[model samples]
Target chain A: MTDSKDTGEAGEVKKDHGVLYIGMDFGTSRTSVSASNGVRETVYSTVGYPKDIVSMKLLKKDVLFGKDAIERRLSLKLYRPLEKGVIKMGDDADAESKANLKAARDLIGEAIRIAKPRADELVYCVIGAPAKASIHNREAIIEAAREHVDSVMLCSEPFAVAYGLDWLEDVLVVDIGAGTTDLCRMHGTMPEETDQLMFDTAGDAVDAELAKQIQDTCPGAQFTVQMIKDIKERYGFVGEAAERVVVDLPVDGKPTPFDLTDQLKTACTVLIEPILEGLRRLIATFDPEFQAKLKGRVLLAGGGSMVKGLDTAVEKAMNERLGGGKVIRIEEPVYGGSNGALKIAHDMPEDFWEQLK
Target chain B: MAGFKETLKDAVRQMSFRTSLDKLKKKGVQNVNVLGVDRIIALIEAAVHRSLKSRMVGIDRDAVAESTKAEFLRLLRSNEDLQREKSQIEQARERAEEEIDLMRRELGEKRSLLRVKLEQDAMELVTRYSGENQAIAMKVAEICRSFAESGDASVSSVEERLMELVMDVVSGEREEAEVARKALQDREVGNLQRRIKKLNDTLVTTEQRLQQASTMKQFDRGISSIYREVQGLDGSDSHAGKKRELMVDLFKANLKLQKRGKGA
Candidate 1:
């Protein structure tokens, strides 16, 4: 048999090896990965550790992930380690920050593990980060990913979406993610800082607005942020109402159905003005010759884009506000960034990969 | 190139089976044509190159040859990794089997020892109780004899008194012996029962561990990737150049960030 050293460390021997390219979209609400091996998976960005010895024994696992973590959160020291589309390491360096960093690292490792890379292949990864992520936040992400991959790189999230769709020039992408909405304009080149815009008026904000509306209108209704977010994901829409969203909430430990159709519609409508504002800023600031092209090819992507009739609503808003425009939602909103990053990883020259290693 | 050839030879040898001359002769005629190892290796290389040249065009022959060699070496390395993992798992399974066997043997020995001790204690209790009963009977007979020999009352009255005394003494002695025997038996049996229970618990725990180890061994087959070799971007892709440029930009940014992190 060939010696065990054949699969040894990267530089130990000059054995010809295959490269496993992985593209990751790490978001506040979910982390998705697309690998060259054709594995695509998305996980909720939640990590949990058993609280004590008894819990650890009962769980039979040191850590729980995603939905399992959420379900068993009471028995766990749960951490949702990302906020506003970046690692939530608070300004001060403290125990909580360190714990969050660890959770982020673990979450990244779990994302890679789910890709199921072969041990004999070299692993190179590309991660799509928030456009406005600080250097420290980017560095933290790199450090976390480096533990699981041989080499890693980062790109802007909305730009990755645009790139994945092969729209290199005069295409505007609005990625409505859980924590933030990122608007990036592509114009035949890598976008500069001025080409992108970010704001927090996205999925989480809609959940908060919906929760507030419920509290104001539906007396004695009890719910959590997670429950409200789930409700929005299931029945959220703008423009014409498809159907009434009548959901049951516990009222004094009794199941009570509340008519939240108007509330949900109002909460979801909050995204339009801010998104149009972002669009106006990007389209108005672009070169006058390409403004029409940018407006006509506006692509809606991300989890928040999954809201029903959002594209038509955005199109309607664009007609009244900025002459006229077309809004097109991507075929796969959740996998857009990761798919683009995978394309980048594939097209990356071998020398660049080798140098990074 | 020499190392690659040697690795290929090793892989070939590993895949081939060994047999004795007697078995070979039984299967076929004995005479064999032997070739030098170097000659065999040269022939294989020439055959691969000729095959590639027949099917390929536009790409340089040398580049094709190099890539073929690289692909061959990569497959060989992957095979080697799988082999190593298989060997490790096999060893683990064997170790778990041995541990389970030892535990079973120990459990059997402990059970047999407990049974023997319990049987010996029962025998000793039976022997001691019979001996005490015989002594009590003799004492009762002696009191009756003394009462008959002494002249105190009428014969019939003396006989009735003797009988009553004998009955009372024997009845009291029998109750005392029964209680003592029961207490002794309960203490010894309780101690032995506790030991047997402890051994049974240990046996169950060891069996569970063995079961876990076996399950792990069964699950040791590593996950397989969809692509067997490196897959670069398809040449027909329209944005290959643009994507390449983006890749370069991304690399430069990450390099700077990583460098800064290291500096800090």
Candidate 2:
């Protein structure tokens, strides 16, 4: 493969290999990737390994991910590797934690594999990690990604969202994910430690709250957390709902319809308070001259932003609490971080990648 | 050269195997000769020494003997390598067979799953159509009863008119629907058959690849990349300078984190 490469001034053979740049948004619920080769994919963060000999024989697979893993969960030992925006690996880890780490590693590998990078290409990747992930968590993520790519870098998730849209300066980004909501203030240069805040009141919290509400309001309605999550993803809204959120739950082995409008709104409402508070803190600490600019361009991104009327709800709250603010929901919330990470990967100089490799 | 003795001994042992006396007689080999390893080695050396003594009177006998031994050892080494390559090919062939078996099993699973899905759809359609037919019949009967009570027509006349409507209108509609349903089923079956054909084609290709691999195992070179080195920020990009600085900061942080991790 290197036989036809040109020699340099020093008479040293220089290899001429192709480069495949990949951007990964490694979130608690989903792992999304976009490659320079125009391949984009999103998979659930769930990983499953066949439980035993019989299950292995039936599945004819060593592991499964995404929809396949979710569907065949009963026959597999499932692992949601990331929780609360960080890989769940600690120093004094137990066997389950070790297994989760393995699953996380495999999930990263799978994300790269789905990008379909050429074998002879140099896979350069940039991952958008949680803003407040611990050093240990960051190391874990780097280790996992390094196994698949030639070079990798980790940037703050919310910052990536803002950068993706070229809203680098005087912009506040609120990335609401399943496990945690990350808020970062971008002021031209790289965001500092004080520019970011994280809270665990995003999508999963809504699901939990909705489950509690369903249990309280709809008696005799049987549902699991998974079913509640689906309901929230389908019908979750805040403020005045355009239509009633009615869903069916099994009762005595028969489907029964139940109204869940109030529950869904109340559940989805949990996101607003924390996000507004985060915005206030970030905007309040900004340069007084640029504070207005920052509040004026608040970018709402990530999967949780898909909740109907969420942007308007946040804008309303900001009006009431932070005087006034505009929340612009990104057109492609799910791909925002990944797309930004891809931009970052593309802009990184060759020297930086070589040093990392 | 060091393994020459071992290779020679192995060659001798491999060609010799035990057989029943009756089997040997049946093969018309009732007599056999046994040679010990040490005697065979001595006889080979003596033959070589005698041949060299007679063939080259003026030449250095010791030098020629050494050269001949080196050449023979080289041949033996190549034969050993061939033996190793043969074993590797056998293992690869076995793996290919196992892969074929696995693919066949997967194909079976897919076929059965498709069967179950189609059957479920058929049953659901039947249940839905039966309910619709029952509702239509009840509505027709109700219309006939209402007509009889109104005294606009005789009950027998209403019954005959209703039968005519059923035969002329509903049955024709049902026939068209049946044709459309059959066409839809044919489209679905055609899709599945195409998928099966694709699977069969892939199987054949994989089998061909296995044969090729067994013959020559040299072409595992992977795909090529588009660039030789990492592409930095484009010069024309307006945000190039700032983005590069941010990228550098991120790289430094990551470098420190990785170094710390390694240190730990």
lDDT (10s digit) by residue, model 2, range B12-64: 66656767889988989968886788688668778988998998899889867
Residue pairs of candidate 2 with colliding backbone atoms: A17-B227, A17-B228, A18-B225, A18-B226, A18-B227, A19-B227
lDDT by residue for model 2 (A1-357), tens = 112344332222233457888889999999999888788899999999999999999997899998899999999999999999998877888998899999999999999888887645678999999999998888888888876677888999998888789888888999999999999998888889999999999889998998899889999999987798788878888889898877989999999999999999999999999998899998989889989888899999999999999999999989988899888999998899999998888888888888776
Q: How does residue B208 of candidate 2 score in lDDT?
A: 92
Q: Measured against the native two-chain assembly using Cα atoms, what DockQ does each of the candidate structures obtain, in the order listed?
A: 0.18, 0.23
Q: lDDT of model 1 at residue B113?
A: 72
Native-to-model Cα distance after best TM-score fit, residue B54 in candidate 1, in Å:
42
Q: What would the per-residue lDDT of candidate 1 be over residues A37-64, giving only the tens digit for each residue?
A: 7889999999999999999999988899
TM-scores of chain B alone in all candidate structures, in the order given: 0.69, 0.55
lDDT of 1 at A219: 97
- Candidate no. 1 TM-score: 0.67
Worst 10 residues of 1 chain B by lDDT: B219-228
10 residues in a row with least lDDT, candidate 2 chain B: B218-227
Name the lDDT value of residue B66 in candidate 2.
74
- Global Cα lDDT for candidate 1: 0.84
- Model 2, runs deviating above 4 Å: A1-16, B1-229
